[model samples]
Target: MTEALLNVVGVSRSFSAGEDELTVLKEINLQINRGEMVAIIGASGSGKSTLMNILGCLDKPNKGHYFINGQDTSAMDENELAALRREYFGFIFQRYHLLGDLTALGNVEVPALYANEGPHERQKKATQLLTRLGLSDRLEHKPNQLSGGQQQRVSVARALINGGDVILADEPTGALDSTSGEEMMKLLRELHRDGHTIILVTHDPHIAEFADRVIEIKDGEIKDGEIIGDTRNDNVNAYQSSDRAATELVDNPPQTHPQTAKQQTTKYRINWSRYLEALKMALIGMSNNRLRTFLTMLGIIIGIASVVSVVALGAGSQQSIMANIASMGTNTIEIKPGTGRGDRRSGRIRTLMAADADALKTLSFVDSVTPTVRANVAIRYASETVTGSVQGVGTDYFRVRGYSLAQGQFFAEGNALGSVIFLGHLPVRVIGVTEPIESVSSNSDELNVWLPYTTVSGRIFRQNYVSDITVRVDENVESEVAEQGIISLLTMRHGTVDFFTINTDTIRKSIEKTSATMTMLISAIAFISLLVGGIGVMNIMLVSVTERTREIGIRIAVGARQTDIMRQFLIEAVLVCFCGGALGIGLAYFVGVIFSYSGSDFQMVYSGTSIIAAFACSTLIGVLFGYLPARNAARLNPIDALSRD
Candidate 1:
């Protein structure tokens, strides 16, 4: 009936002056109808580009109430404006605005790539458009390989790939020769003929003539504006039809305009097809700069690898230490007798004696008490004597340690002085065994002799049996409490805080502390790699901004919001690093395999949480380091960008 496509009333724009605000545009009014072409023409500094930017949704006016196809423009923020632009506008720029590294089809595919379209959709659309532009042969040819006219065609094709509602062309041929310029202008006319609504901004009067309507601005004011060749003789008839249809459409609406708040609004929804295209574009970009991408990713990869490797190593070391300590015995308490060195109240005083060991055995919680008298001793087995440390103890040593007899049976009580001795499997392997050794060396070749500790022909091996007492507490008693009770009992003999003591729980705590410190140290070293990678991403993204200056300008001119540009660069950076992180994860897995082969008793658990954390960190680095470069691109003046060589 009387549906409005775009409405702008009394819009004004200005900038700062020394002390007074300088007016750029004053009281500008304009409207654009669906399926129509309008050109805005003016000299430089006449605010024509500024007005075009507002109309293309690139910016908001300093003072204006504007509506586009019935949607209010005043209420949108930068991101919302970007979504609106992506949903509705396609931009073609002067200077061909083609990315130097991309082929013709790639140039056409950039926008859809930003939209993240699928590869199939991007390829089909890009190929179809390039073919239509007579660039089927040049699809694989890069921008430098094509003529200026052909490059502009690629740009035009890019604008058309997304099914956007409007095309915004800013001086579309300003950088082309006359013939090539004419060719590009003809392409625009062709696009218009194909039913696309276009708003071409140009200073050339001939270029403005290509549009169906032209608005001329001078000194920031519209000097002339009008539409031609659409005049109908019967205004009364047209107005009468509009008047009647307005009431009918408004009253008996098929759908309520102001439906309940819960209803879904009618904003255009961008298909997910473009996002896939963006991913493909990113892949191509990385391929074009393979070295840069690899270098960038190397930081993250090395960091993750170092983290995993160091953690594995540290974890293994901790386990080994704990196992060795626990292997000695579980819930075993150590009691050391000290010679009198200082204060008698101190445990260093010689208060513990063999009598103390006898007294400890009487305690209710004590399972078994083994008094160890260790020294290097020689074994005489028919002149093949081997020397090793001796552990002199009663039969109770076997009960507390539960050591397996790989060779011979443990010594029995009555076997004392019967030439009986138990050799550890390690020592047994060192010495050769000739006899069956049914008494001692049944498993190993070691030559050991065990004799009674009570009396061996009246010869004394040990004087005081309390050098160290290994107290095996009952498992029925909790280790910590039992240890405390043992400490209290021994403290009287070896006074308070006199002797160094440890238990199963104490060793376990030490192991945990060691593991924690190791994990943190490894992580710190790994983070250095990530930081280096972040610097790489930042550097590359900055380069990209500089390289794609004109492209960024074109996107902004076409209604791409600031955040859109930010997202493009940030995602590109992140994609590169994240890809590297993924590869690193694979590499770490291989390293884990290698570690397993090396006989390291550690489980290299590269859990999903770790992978996701690495990936997320990579992405975060991209956003953090790529932000400034992206912002630099976004803050660029669209006119200056279009004018860039």
Candidate 2:
């Protein structure tokens, strides 16, 4: 005779119950032939369903050998068993086992997708199956939207999608009414007549009578096995004569030829269609729970915003400071008396003089030169009496200091001050009022006055020596080189190194270094916040896995591989963080806009590199933090997952 399509020899199954092993099936011997309609009937808890699970390769037997078409399945791995289920066996459950998130058409196409079918092919096949199953109008309806009978019909269509060579129905009609039950049994009979091997597990005698052979199972043992019914021939004649609609329902035969084991084991190539389906499912999951998704993304949003904003704020502050420095004179040098600052007895030296300024002005590298002498004096102007510094300066002092006048012009060589101001009981005219210089002093209330050096030395203090000289270096000359030239000339004239020069360029370098350090420090703190956001993503993903346990089981039942399940959850997590990153960038820009409008002295300067880095960081967090949850989902036992609420 033909080799048995399914052969079970001495198969004994057991489950752990507390401290002891509870045996479910004992020495179960069964044989099922291709193209034969058989029923394994028993009462509840009789292990009939367990036997059917073994036959369908959904569960393994503790002891014995189960074979499919003369090939032993004892050495097959989890993935190999999944391939068997995908290519050969199809399951119909009492609860209908339809994915809640998928439409009827989508649910029917699931198995075909896992079988590596293309989108257009699977969609066309799914549409035809649903249309023939009387669900053409309900193709887009979700499981919750369909009635009990309609859902079971969709489940039947799903089972037949990937060539159901052997169909296992575990109480398929238990949840349906009498009329719907009769209709379902009729559909099964039609499939059986179309050369599909039908294995029905039920306690209802009426349902058992529809099959050609009935095996009575009791207490995990086959009690009576015989060909009790001659219903095949009679049903064939009756169906042909009376059930014209049922004949039209299953007019086209299912695809019975499946890929060989070698073909199934071929190295898996990247399937873009499968990945796209996973992406679509991920989007649907996120859309269904908008609040949870947004909350999960909030941490990433805050972290990315902090990092980008801090970088921008640092850059803006640095630019503002550098601009102020530039206004003080690009290449200016200051000459002070004595060896250096805070020197003792420098006032008694009296070596610096106006002749030095006149000599420096003759050099080609010196743009302008000014000699300065200062003394604290009491000044009276309009009813305000204040102590201020009265400075003796050359005609080019304003040009050397890069000062712009707010009102009135600088005094000429012999011109007197325009307005009289008292200096130590001597009255002197004011030449001009300089614009407010931020670099000069922090206190805006400080007072200053300027006069010609000759007037201060001869008329006011009656001293001939000058305190110091200020030099504006030519644009083509380096400040350091010019400083060296002046030191050489002055030390030769004085016969010793009695003065020191301060290069404004050196101060600019120091300030820039300090600003950069501050930016790096703040950015490091922001990176810590990003790390915390990654941890938050991991926690929420763990919760998601627990909530969708049943959904995971459904995919497994439809032949989804471990990697397929993992890809779904991982992609969902990445999408969450990616969207969060985009929102965070937007938030950072919004902060910049508000800061600019607040009338602050400096504006935020956002960097393109920082924004791109933030996006990469968020995507990496999604993968790093999302792995454990995805692995937990993929590693779940199919039976345990299905049984969970």
Candidate 3:
């Protein structure tokens, strides 16, 4: 008189085996009314599991239609199928299908987690259900710590968590011992009497007799379909074994609001509580295998540390170079002559003259111009005969080159141009030292001998050619404008621009550019290591997915969408990498401090951008590489994963 809760018509299923097709279920039809206890009995490979898969909507029938609660399921999408499972069906596997990482209470709360229940409500319901199942004292025990009978009881409580009315049991008592199996059958019968529709698959006729109806399948076809009367003559009795517990469970019954609870859960969206719970479960999963988790994260840590350290060192080198350049003065420029254009044999340009120097001084932004002529000569200062290069320059050379005198006054201009050649090759004499010079070979001014331009040109070398010119630019004038003026005047005087080179704004910029380029190059090289780290992450995550196939299946059967599975795994990967990045930054900082305090010339520089970039890249690496494994996990067939050993 009432509509059947589930209906199947002309349903069939098949699989491809290399070159041939294998049909698992052929021309099968069945119907299950509400509150009816039905048994599907068959031998192995009889297509009973396939039919059950179709009935539970975990798989689709190839050539027929199936309807649940009067709605055809053949045309439904994945989201709708997931919703259907959550709203209507509950599953209990023979192996219990409990997540090993979660506690007994946590396992019972899983379906409710997907239901978007509040934490308090979910935990309360889980506690109540466990207490009813006689697992109150063992609520915190993990699956591996529980006995076979206790695990099955936990699965029963999980099935009923979302207020699902139909229970699909596939060989629920197959793995248990005689006593445990008997107790499980008694629990199923009690559930059936309490207005729950039960469909069980088993090969034992004794198990089938406990149901109100039995359908026997053989060779992918139904061979016998019979309705059995309840004789109530079985020795298995749940009431006798645990009468007090059964009475309490019946009275409380896990509080179902009937249509309203299912409706609310169906319309539910995931919130922070569910995400936090997933994270908590993932952490627990990782913590159980601590060594493996650390091994998986090691690659990421090394990669991040390498990147940060290299960049910091580069930044420090750049800073040191810039500081040295600043000490040489930013507003100074040096000019030199290029070699003869077509003839490389003439390396010196002898055309520079004093008249050209006078022309450069007339430029608007030119502060001072000094013509230089260098010649190595031996100076006999008492007993110390120091061989050094003498620079022929003017009084403005001291101001233009940022040189300060440590002792003795500079020679006046009157004696500078006097053509008095002192015998014994006294070309020029060292008048002062700029800073405390260490030795003649050190980079200092101790060996430098300065003399006036006119004296060296007319008296010492006996020639009028100048070697090079130095120009000091005004603070207000741009270097480009001043350089162009100098180049134009010198080219006009010489009638050729190729004979000379003009430099302005010192060598600081070139050296800075070189340091920056080197930093980028090292960082790029380090990035390769990061990419390798990413590959390592993907490899380990793939292995993890394979190792936890059964757990993934358990989540799917309880109404987790593909997105839910993807989100969980993605979060796990990001958490690992982000944490690794933080640790790497800390390591680098520690290394930097040690280097700075060791009294060495090497300095480690810390850049906020470098650390931030490393952090962001770590998270990005997780997303990029974690995708393949998460996708593989999400796309797995629920039935295949559930059946995985």
Q: TM-scores for all candidates?
A: 0.64, 0.79, 0.75
Clashing pairs in 3: none
Supply the TM-score for candidate 1.
0.64
Query: For residue 405, what is the lDDT in candidate 2?
Result: 85
In candidate 2 the C-alpha lDDT for residue 615 amounts to 95
Residue range 391-439, candidate 3, lDDT tens digits: 7897787767665566555666223332333324653444455544322
- Cα lDDT tens digits for candidate 1, 1-645: 555567788888877889898777777878777666777877777777777777777667888778876667898666566655665677776666677767888777666655556667888999999899898899999988888888888888888787655788889889889998888877877666666777888889888777777777776234322211232223111111123322232223232376554443322223333344346656877888788778777776776666556655566666666554444465577666442334354343444455566667888888887665554566444436567545555557655553444443555522222233323321221221123222111233443343223322124353544345667777577677877776777777655655544565565566669788878877887888778868877887787778778777766654555766666666677787777777877777888889778876655655566667777887788778878887888787766676666
Please tell me which model should have the higher lDDT, number 1 or number 3.
3
Winner by lDDT? 2
The count of residue-pair clashes in candidate 2 stands at 1
Q: List the global CA lDDT of all models.
A: 0.66, 0.83, 0.77
- Native-referenced Cα lDDT, model 1: 0.66
- In model 3, state the lDDT of residue 382: 51
Q: What lDDT would candidate 2 get against the real structure?
A: 0.83
Better of 1 and 2 by TM-score: 2
Task: Tell how far residue 45 is off in model 2, in angstroms.
Answer: 1.6
Q: Model 3 — TM-score against the truth? A: 0.75
Residue 512, model 2: Cα distance from true site in angstroms: 6.6
